[model samples]
Target: MDRSLRNLAVALVVGAMAPLFDSTIVSVALHSLAADLHAPVATIQWVSTGYLLALGVTVPVVGWLQRRVGGRRLWMAALVVFLVGSVLCSLAWSAPSLVAFRVLQGIGAGAMLPLLTTLLMQAAGGRDLGRLMAVVSLPTALGPILGPVVGGLILGAASWRWLFWVNVPFAVAGLLLAWYLIPADGPRTKARLDVVGLVLLSPAVVGLLYGLSGVGGSGGFSRTAVWLPIAVGVALLVAFTLWALRHRGAALVDVHLLRHRPLAASASLLFLTGASLYGAMLLLPLSFQELRGTDALGAGLLLVPQGVGALLSRTLAGRLNDRFGARVVAVVAFAVLGAATVPFALMGPGTPVWVVVVVLLVRGVGLGAVIIPLMAVGFVGLERDEIPHASIITRIAMQVGGAVGVAVLAVVLQRGVAAVGPVAGFQQSFWWAAGLTGASVLLSLVLPGRPRVAAPATPEEAREPVAA
Candidate 1:
């Protein structure tokens, strides 16, 4: 990569890392936060839940906001907002206060997630999307691995509040880099804000996520608390879909992009990937903590092999996708993921730690391979103008799917633990996770066939860049 491209890559990766870090960091600190604030575990859980709900609620608005305010300005502004929220969260006096502040952080974070991809792709001018996405996605691979370790270290040496405080340097650096590195806005068109769509979609997302979250809580699925909001949310979302279809070209998400085979397939695979990846995420830590009697730090450290495997595979995965296409790589990767999960299903309290680590390492390689190519494939055969819309749709799908995965796994774990105990519960969850991975393998079959190599850009074509 050229220096400018390298700088842009660095900026995007650093910018993207903040939210991933926060997600993991907060997980390890949940118990500490609850104890310190004298809050029940149930209530303290909202610190993470609220953040996720807010992310789901706000993500849909990124494309519209980018068009309205310009990507660079919005990115920098979001960094500032996140920094402020992070500082406030560090000083929060109670669980509710912290949750509220986390929502603020989430609003900033939600925008950052989609914008990171959109902006980087825009900057790259579609020259080497597979490679760029791999670099951009490195943080996601690292976050699960490093987050808990960082959180644990802070908890051991400092206070839980430092977890929030730690985000400051990253956010500040991201803001500075974005202002300097990211290109200024191109010519603007007078695009109308999808206020109606936003109004309808935000609550729909929040309600669905809130309802799903309640599934594993005391109310369970049949309770009014669990079903009511989800039902309402689904109704609103369906209405929004109809409304968006009617609006078509003018819709916030541009539902027409679904007609693009590559984008659609990519989104579907993302859903399944989210189901498997995050479902396993929930099970893995709980298995170690609850069944194996590992503490937060130990559980976090044990996951390092997976991260290492992911990091090791990313460059090779990206290069292979560029050579062989997303379809082949994704299918094989998902299959590998499913195979890796089989070991977890068979694991017991007495299972050797080395065996567990080896399984995680294999699982990590599969995960690393899946994410980068799956993300890049969404833009295949898409026009430059359509990239942002595709980005938004895929992002929302992944986030919502992740929420579903977490909920489904939570329910599975709860029931499995109740009936058979923690070890069996984790094993059952892993089986379910393996199933989801298998579904992703099926979904990957629909992705576009081997990508045809583009002819090299001529001097004039290189000089006259296409707008993202």
Candidate 2:
């Protein structure tokens, strides 16, 4: 990578960290949020679910939005929106209001996430994708480690409002750095906005996610309420896929990209990876709090070693992916993840903390290794112009996988808790998580073999809007 591209990546990563960490920061504060707002646990969950749905709602339109407004301006604008929403969320007096403000925050966050990847790779001019992903993944590697600990510290000493307040400095600093260091947005010239396509795609994603999220509270997919939205969402998504197939490049998300072997494999693997990684995160904290009687902060602190392990592996994983290929690295990583998860699958309440800590550290390394490679390998053969489409497609897959994973596992966990005990509940969830990653080991076979040094785009291809 060129020095200039490296500098841009760093600046973009700094901005990227703000939205990336916000939800995770808010995760540990949910129980506190319920108490303070005097709301039922069911209602309070909207704080998280609403944010997730809002993300789904915004993601499909972002590729168009990125082109119409230009990425730099759109990013800054999204940050400003997030900052305003954060301040509003901090001041919310009720659960309903907090949930509403979180939606606003989520919209900004939704746009920011995919754009972060698009802007960085677009600037890198498609060189050394694996190395680029290594740098760009800093927030991903750190968020799991620091977010809960930070959230725990705030909730331990201060009001739940401080959770939203903490995002201010990062948002402000990121905005400033982006303004100075990032290039200005290119002129807006995009393929015509596909209104029908957007109508079908956006609501389809939002409804699917909303329905999946309801599965946890409703107990399972068997409930009418849980299944209804899911059925409708799936129908809508199927219709949209048909529409995209007819229109080809004119559709909103360009579903045609799935034909690319690397993109398809990477997106599929990301889906399962999201499910496994996210499901484990949900189970770990709640189980620690319920079964071990650890406080929120204490639980967060206990997970720090996992974060350390991920941080330690970042460079090594990136080098290996670039050199040896995503296939080998991803397969080995998934195997390690599945194997490390075994102890958790069998763990009891009295299982030693030292053992959990060791397992988490190793598991974190496997997760970090697999994710960085998958993120890079998808773009191996794409032109710079096609990146935004790939970005949206991959993001949607990963996000959907994560929400469904947590929901299904949460229902499973609840049942296990009712049947046996909290320890047993988490144990069952870990088994499911292990199974998810284990399946991905087979899916990894489809990833591109040892990557050949890719060809860069022509000068004109680099200049076209991402939607082009």
Candidate 3:
């Protein structure tokens, strides 16, 4: 990547680290949070649940926010919002207070997630997506690996409040870098927010996400909680589609952009990617604990190989995608991912630790390859103004897909375990993951374009207003 793109990636990634790590890192603290606040586990779970729900609701409106405030200012404002929320969370007096602060934190984080992608893609001007994704994927690839380790170390040595406090430095540093490195967007003084579209879309996303989350502990889709909100959410989405198609350029999220094949295909595959990747994440830890008699820490450490593999693969995948196109790269990537995942499905107690670790390394590479190409493709042919809308659409797809994946896999495991043993149950679940990934392989064929660098914009194109 060139220097400007590199700087933009660095600025965005640094700022993004706070929220990305904030999400997964908190998973380790749930039990302690429950005891310290004298709340039931169910009540305390909202600390995470509220954050995610707030995220779901907030993400759909980011396009309007970006147009109104400009990317650079919006980014800096979001950092401060997150920073203040983090500080309040550290001082939370009770479970209710913590959950409330986390919702605020989630709102800020929701804006940041899709905005980061928009800013980076804008800076690149559609050139070097493959190479740029390599740089952008650094924190993303590291967050899951580091989240547990960082959260575990802090919880081991200090009060659980430190979990919230830990985000302070990253927020501060990210704000500083963004202010210095990110170019100020020329404000679109005439732009107007799509109130009607936002009203319909925001709750639709939240309802769907909430319903998907319910699919886990309750029976999958068979229960009212899982099916009701989902049905309502889908209905709202269809309503928004009708409204957005009418508004066209004024829609809060332009469903019209789905006409772009690259964007549509990328969104589709990201759903499966989310399902497969997260489903495996759920199964891996449980398999280690139930089958291998490993503790939480040991199970997390076992996951290190997959993360390392992903890390090693990002640069290679990006380079290949830039050189070879997403189609060839994605097909091979999913195949590797599917093949690596199968070992877990077939593994017995007699399977060696070294063998599992080796397979995990290969699995990580598949993750690195599959995610970067899919993410990059959505913006491949998008106009400058359409990027923010595309970013929100893709992020929601991946998030919802992941929620559905985790919920589905959990249900599958429950059924499998009831029918057989824990080992057999886990293997069955892993088979589901592998099969889901294989399905993604078929979807990968629809992703657009040949391998080549994106053409740089001329000065005239650069000066044009980035509008729908």
lDDT of each: 0.83, 0.84, 0.87
lDDT of 1 by residue, 1-468 (tens): 567887888887787788878988898888888999999999999998899888888888888788888888888888888889999999999888999999999999999898888887766665666787789889877886778888998999998889988898888888788778877884355688788888888889888889887887764788899899899999989988888999977788888778777788888888887777777778888789987899988998999999988898899888887777888888888888889999899889999999999999998999898998789888765555667888888888887787789888888888988899878888898899888998888888877666555533664443221211
Judged by lDDT against the true structure, how good is candidate 1?
A: 0.83
TM-score of each prediction: 0.94, 0.94, 0.95
Could you list the CA RMSD of all candidates, in the order they appear? 3.7, 3.5, 3.4
Residue 242 lDDT in candidate 3 = 100
Please give the distance, in angstroms, between residue 237's alpha carbon in candidate 3 and its true position after superposition: 0.9
Q: How close is candidate 3 to the true structure, as a TM-score?
A: 0.95
Better of 1 and 2 by lDDT: 2
Tens-digit per-residue lDDT, 181-293, candidate 2 = 88997756756898888888888888889888888764588888888888888988999999999998688888887877778888999899889878888888887788789
Provide the lowest-lDDT 10-residue window in model 1: 459-468
* Model 2 vs. true fold: TM: 0.94
Instruction: Report the number of clashing residue pairs per model.
Output: 0, 0, 0
